[model samples]
Target: MGLIITFLAAAFLIAGVVRGSFVNKRANEELPFPTPVSQEVEGSTDDRDVPYYDDDKEEDEVIETITPFIPTPTVSDSQTSDSSATNAYIYPNSTVLSTTANSIELSSTSDPGDITNWYKKLFEEKHFKARSFAQTNTNGHVLNKLAGAGGSLDLEVEIEKKPNEKITVIKVTY
Candidate 1:
């Protein structure tokens, strides 16, 4: 048994040495000539990939911000009754942030499980056709279509929660 163990140890050492050369990556080599001029350099205009650019030829940029088709329910004079209750956000102490590109970010103190169920019920009640709703751990993906903007909008609602924290964040990408 001692002889067999000694032989096995010797075989493993040789195998490891042989594997090292095969798995090791090549070392970085210095360039034979200077680096290409197109590469980014400090205080160089080469970053734009053009030798020269005329300020007079620049075009004006116009950005059109999109608005969400579905607005959150609010108490109004016309909706003073039961309809206001349906439009109001159900999660207490939650904030929804609206971005310039029609994206919505929501943060709440509720758990991911509760948020998922609330959204599922909300979308279903609003007659939004759900294409996919998947949940794993604290991550969720919800794809639904509103009454409008189905032709051009690639809308997505994503939910993520960090471990060892009570905050769950949701993002709506439109």
Candidate 2:
């Protein structure tokens, strides 16, 4: 009886291994799992709820369609029609990015320290009180004066030079 019981146990273990192998083989031959399918709901008129795909779309074209921001150069300081239009003098070698009624943005390749010193002297000569500050990557100045319109006007100039970059951004606000 002990021998018969031991043989039956061995036969059962062998049968389990064979069955498991068969199941694994079938799993590999077929899809391991069912894929999710999108279903449309009845009476849904909103097209946004549906998914649309264009098979011809290429990712390369999407990258090519992007436009870069290019700075637009303004008239040179000497070529400015009216000095009053811009109360503060623009850097001679700077490229103007944009201009508004009370502010101007520019890009330059000059050293930040040189630009700050130039502005300080220019403002002082014009009889405006100026204060300047400097740091590792940036320098700026603030000029104050009694406005002809009976109020005080302050001009702020900031220059930033990022590490490993050739372009310096300058912003002037009045």
Candidate 3:
């Protein structure tokens, strides 16, 4: 048993020496590196120290001033109501989809009932009478206000929330 162990150890040491010799030979070889190629310009001379520039003549000096631009601010609901002739009021935080002379469509992330309630309060504050209809996913209101010279202005508002949706659609007609 001792003789067999001695032979196995000698065989392993010889195999390691052979493998290390091959690795060392590979490591000593030089690696190839890339070199850059110089490009010559069409009008340049043989001198390499001076640079080439096309513009040789000096021109007159010109100074220009730059001004910062400012954008116009958007009108809020309260500010818009006082200036509009129809006294139309849009819900805050709602995105307007379309608008015409007599109608407006809007989209909101609020519930249908909340939008309906807001319109009801707005009508009451304007001293107008409104009739409301409500269902599980929809609400509607018809509002009336006295116009000048014995004429009446009618406004219709509808709010709908589709099933399993977080968005509500609003349609207002005047």
Candidate 4:
């Protein structure tokens, strides 16, 4: 009687495990999956919700279509003209990144003295009010007073030579 009861219990446990796994297979197969809507689809929630983008547009056309990352450079209140730019000599490798109505910022690989020589002429030849002398072996600035329509335009050129840097940062600002 004990052997019969044990055998019946094992058979019932095996049958329950098999029935649970197989029961869901037919139900899952009968139901269809919810497909995702494509971006290219027209007149649905997917089409109206997505932002517009065209792949076939030309290079220039696409550039024109998109907004600029940076705002366009505007002339500041203390702006100077390009007259000083033409007068001053620049190194061949120097890059003039920006030029405003009143100021110019550039970087050069040439000697700082060479740049100072050009600014010196603005005082001597053109009669711009300039500093008497520059200190030796330091970041020296040549300040010149340029008489503007408003008043005296403070033109200061900083000759900064950093250690281990090949390029000298020269900023001529008024």
Candidate 3 overall Cα lDDT vs. reference?
0.64
TM-score of 4: 0.39
lDDT of 2 by residue, 1-98 (tens): 99999999999999999999999996776332333444565787764445445444433323225588999988886555464647456877799899
Among these predictions, the greatest lDDT belongs to 2
Q: Which wins on lDDT, candidate 1 or candidate 3?
A: 3
Cα lDDT tens digits, model 4, 1-174, are 999999999999999999988987756754333344335547666445554555444343222256669978998854645564543633344788777666677888877676666656654654555455463453443232222121354456666667667777767666
lDDT of 2: 0.65
How close is each model in CA RMSD to the real structure?
23.6, 22.0, 22.8, 21.1
Per-residue lDDT of candidate 1, residues 96-118 (tens digit): 65443345677887767777676
lDDT of 2 at 89: 60
Tell me the TM-score of model 3: 0.42
Worst 10 residues of 2 by lDDT: 142-151
Question: lDDT ranking from best to worst?
Answer: 2, 3, 4, 1
| Pairs of residues clashing in candidate 4 | 79-101, 79-102, 80-101, 80-102
Model 2 TM-score is 0.42
